[model samples]
Target: MFQESGVMNSEVVGKRRKAELVFQFRSSLYFVTGNLSVNKDMTEENTLV
Candidate 1:
């Protein structure tokens, strides 16, 4: 029983870690795209001027 519980705990931890990593990756991707759009807008304004 003890060994079974330990395995289950590790599984839970692994899933949680995976979820956190996915969340971090998505947020970073969003940030990068946001920055790119902002930079594009700034360049367009500069060209207009």
Candidate 2:
């Protein structure tokens, strides 16, 4: 039925949106972690001298 198809489509769209949001969150986390690590490394080098 047409109604069933519409429901299925909406569900697919919702899933896609959720996946996109999760991916964005994960990417931001990776960026933050990398930045923190770089800063730590720089600080350690400065202290060594």
Candidate 3:
């Protein structure tokens, strides 16, 4: 029973870690994309002028 509980705890920890990594990755992607979009807009406006 103790071994089973330990395994369960480890599994939960692993899942949480995976979720945190995914969240961080997604947030980074969002910011990078936002920056790129803004940059593109600026470049386009400059070209138009």
Candidate 4:
């Protein structure tokens, strides 16, 4: 029973870590895209001027 529980705990931990990594990756991608959009808008405005 103890060994089973230990294995389960490690599985849970691995799943949690993967979820966290994916979340971080998604957030960073969003941030990069947001910055790119902002910069693109600025460039467009400058061209118009």
* Cα lDDT of model 4 by residue, 1-49, tens digit: 9999999999999999999999999999999999999999999999999
TM-scores, all candidates, are: 0.97, 0.90, 0.88, 0.92
* Candidate 3, pairs of clashing residues: none
Model 1: lowest-lDDT 10 consecutive positions: 1-10
| Cα-based lDDT at residue 13, candidate 2 | 100
Q: Pick the candidate with the highest TM-score.
A: 1
TM-score ranking from best candidate downward: 1, 4, 2, 3
Tens digits of per-residue lDDT, candidate 1, 1-49, equal 9999999999999999999999999999999999999999999999999
Error of 1 at 47 (Å): 0.3
Q: Could you give candidate 2's per-residue lDDT for residues 1-49 as a string of tens digits? A: 9999999999999999999999999999999999999999999999998
Locate the minimum summed-lDDT window of 10 residues in model 3: 1-10
- Where model 2 places Cα greater than 4 Å from the true spot, the runs are none
Clashing pairs in 2: none
Clashes of each: 0, 0, 0, 0
Model 4 residue 10 distance off true place after TM-score fit, in angstroms = 0.3
- Stretches of model 3 off by over 4 angstroms after superposition: none
Q: Kindly provide the TM-score of model 2 when superposed on the true structure, using C-alpha atoms.
A: 0.90
On a 0 to 100 scale, what is the lDDT of residue 31 in model 1? 100
**What's the CA error at residue 45 for candidate 4, in Å?**
0.4
The better-scoring model by TM-score among 1 and 3 is 1
